[model samples]
Target: MRALAYFKKGDVHFTDSLPEPKLTSPKGLLISPSFTGMCGSDLHEITDGPIFMPKDGETNILSNESLPLAMGHEMSGYVKAVGPEVTKFKVGDRVVVEATISCVDKHRWPNAKNANTPMCDACKDGCENCCDYAGFSGLGVVSGGFSETMETIEHHVVKLPDFVPMDIAALIEPLSVAWHGARVAKFTEGKTALVLGSGPIGLAMTLVLKARGAKKIVVSEPASIRRELADKFHVETFDPSKHGERAIAELRSIPEGGNGFDFAFDCSGVAPTFNTGIAAIHYRGVYCNVAIWGKGINFNPMDMTLQEKNLTGSIGYTVEDFKQVVDAFEKKKIDPKECEHLITGRIKIEDGWEKGFLELINHKDTNIKILLTPNNHNELD
Candidate 1:
């Protein structure tokens, strides 16, 4: 099987001899990927990583897999084969993989160290996204979609609607990330939102807000290119750099009543964006951190104490989040045409390293989501 894999630190490339993935459980399904999106996390793995990936000679605690694993989590594909006990899907069905691997998945990896261990509190409570050993299939748990085929249990697969194109289906994973953030904030219809940074996740937040009926959505992004991309969604775009010290003040004035936003999501994961997201919201409003910060920042408890504002942060999404996002698309809450704006480029798996990964790293600002295909399904004519 040909795959784009992580060989070691700063060493990811395409290889033709990587072992093919197999269904590891009776309820598992083998899938041939149609399209998979390149993520910022993937770039991080190539540049400053092995963060989530196991070390060169080490094995992932959950899946017991080592480095040189195929890399791609945001994927949509067609079922190629199904284990005898898999009743939810059959061969040839179009599907999208949720991609999260956790303690609840012990049944799938019988040889894992924790296979017989009791379920973690989070998994027992149906929050596998927060499971004690939470890791993504592609990131570390096992070989992922950036290959000829990948396998996973039925629990992580979601069926795609007939109207959704395979390429658009790849966007569902990122949208689910934004959707989970909105869920964490307890966002509701008609609420105004302030989304800090219009990068991939930031722009994704804008789309989710619009689909959920946000009265107003203001995307505060410093980069002109990103702001331009956010504007395509018909949401208001704010250049925070222009306002400087008064950025939060200007952001609050955009929503109705001129008080503050009902919800603010920090997708940029920086000191300024974090402060602006918290400060720009009104009393009792919610501020959700959707970004993956690399370091800690100074914080004062009194900031939220006076306002009674709620603070929360979102991490990996649950399977339910994936279902709801697909429901949103099926019911027309999220327009597929609008979702197309997020896909900046597409390339074959053969060119995934150069045209897909390197393109995103070198020209970060110019692209949003770059998808790679194995060309097995003819999704890329």
Candidate 2:
């Protein structure tokens, strides 16, 4: 078996003659990947170096102790072999694996508010994703999608519709992220939405909002290239050319505006976007932060107090969120133009190292989601 393995520091490459993963569970299934998406977070971990690895004390939870860590998570594949305990799916069923991997017995949410660490009982008993110390696949926390063949627990697998193409099924993971975030925002019919950033996550949020029947959608993106892409998706694009309060003013006055929108989502992970996303929301409105930022920034307590808006932070999705995202595509709720345009490029695994990685990091202005098609011996690359 050939797997793209990440070893040592600042290194990941494809390697041949790796040992094949054994079927270890009664309900487990093995899949030969069709397509795998190279995520930004994967690049972050690669560039951030090794000290900050997501490990559980002595154990490296993200990347297994085994050398040559597997490198993908966003993917879809067909079931090659099913365990005896698996009844819902057969050997030839097309499926998309939910990438989140948690301890079978992990935490629970006790009314959404409380105080504690890993042993909060509810945290371990509820769902691994909600646990503060929950482990995830593809982030080096657990093994991922970049292998010719790999095993997945039946609990994390979702069956895909026959009508959806395999390439489209590869998008279910990120769409789940967007679907979870938009559902949290509470946007509905006749409500306005302002999305910051025209990157993959931002555009994903917009599509979900549009599918959910948002009345008007406005976007604030600094890059003109991304702004044009947003326009192609039929979202009302706005430039973040002006700074401070002026930027918000120019954006809000789009259709002779007053006050602003019912919901705003910050997908840029930039300092200004975070502040402005909240400022652009109406009184008692909802603001969802879907971006991942490692640094801190200031926020005015007075603004939050006076506005009385609900601020929510969304993490990864639940099993239910994954289902909703897949069903949206299956039902054609998400537009085809919106989906294809966002997939800026698709390269083979061999092209991923420098060409694909550098383009995404240094040349962020030109691309969105660059997918990597699996180059398995049986599959056509």
Candidate 3:
């Protein structure tokens, strides 16, 4: 097995002769990954830089890499094997790895708040995703989709219908992320939405809003390509560069002079976007934060109070989000060319650390999500 691994003290690199994972119980599936997208966090884990450095000497979401572990989480693959315990899935099925492993425990069900709180809200009664014991992958703590293969619990896999391409399946994880935000917003077909970024997450949000039947979708972005892509989707795009307008100003011009979005999803997690979300939401509207902004900033709670705006946060997705995304793709709603447009570059697994993952961190403005393919890894070669 040619697994892409972190060269402990050096840049990320791979080696030949990686060990194959033994088949576990019936609860697991062994998948041969077809495509894996390099993520922002993977680069963060490899660098000893700020933001997400390794802690406890062995665990940074990227560096704690369970060394030499394979990486790549946003991916799609074919099930090569299934444990006897698995019931719904079978070998040769194309699926997207959901990338979270969890089990139930009481005192932590239906949390709906605080994902890292070491308790499952759903697990207390047999529901997971909010389980008291939530185990997530691509955390740099667990083996990832970067390698040629992954042994994931059956529940973590979402089977894609035949109509969806394998390449598009790689996007399921991130699409789920956007779906979760929409879920938090409690979107209905006729509601208005504004996605505050043109990045991959932001673009996904735009896609989701359209599929969910948003009456009017506004995507605010400065990048030319992203703005164009949003336009291609028939979304009303707000380009910040040309107008120098804040998000609030853009929405105000829509018709109602700042009546605001029914559901505002902040994808940039930037201070400006936050302020805009607060200022532009209608009364009783929901503002959901899905972007991970690390610092706290000054904002008037009075604004939220006066408008009756509901403030909420969504972490990652439940398995249900993944399912909804696959179904969206199966319905021919997810355009393959549009999905591939989100990809800016592709690199071999061997170059992932130094060249691939590294580029994701330093050159974000130039790329959306860089993908790493085992198509060039030595084991397969």
What lDDT does each candidate get? Answer: 0.90, 0.73, 0.71
User: What is candidate 3's lDDT per residue for 1-381, written digit by digit as tens?
Assistant: 877865453456787766776554457778888778876556656664322223335543221233455666787878889888789889988788887555421112223233245444575553455554454554443456778777777767888777666766787888888998888778888888878887878888888888788888888887876687667677888876676655466675673545677888999888888888777778888889988775888988888999788998887777789998888776766766677777777777777776776676777776777777775432321
Candidate 2 least-lDDT 10 residues: 106-115
Compute the lDDT of residue 77 as modeled in candidate 3: 79
Candidate 1 on 1-381: residue-level lDDT in tens?
999999997888899999988778999999999999999998888888888899888888877888789999999999999999999999999999999898867888778777888889999998898888888878988989899899888999999999999999999999999999999889999899999998899988899999999999999998998899999999889998898788888888888799999999999999998889889999999999999999999999889999999999999799999999999998899999999999998888889888987788789899999998864575342
Which sections of candidate 2 miss by over 4 Å?
A: 49-58, 61-64, 105-127, 242-245, 255-257, 376-381
Each model's TM-score? 0.98, 0.88, 0.85
lDDT of candidate 2 over 1-381, digit per residue (tens): 766656645787777765777555677788877777777777776787443343323345422334556778788888889878877888878888887755541222222222122454534564445655454555555456777777777877899887667776777787888888887676677788899998888888888888878888998887888999889878788888846558887665653367778888888887888888888887898889999988988887777779798899887776677788777776788755467777777777777776677788888888888777665422421
Residue 242 of model 1, lDDT score: 97
RMSD of each: 1.1, 4.8, 5.1
The residue ranges of model 1 lying beyond 4 angstroms of the native Cα positions read: 379-381
State which candidate has the highest lDDT: 1
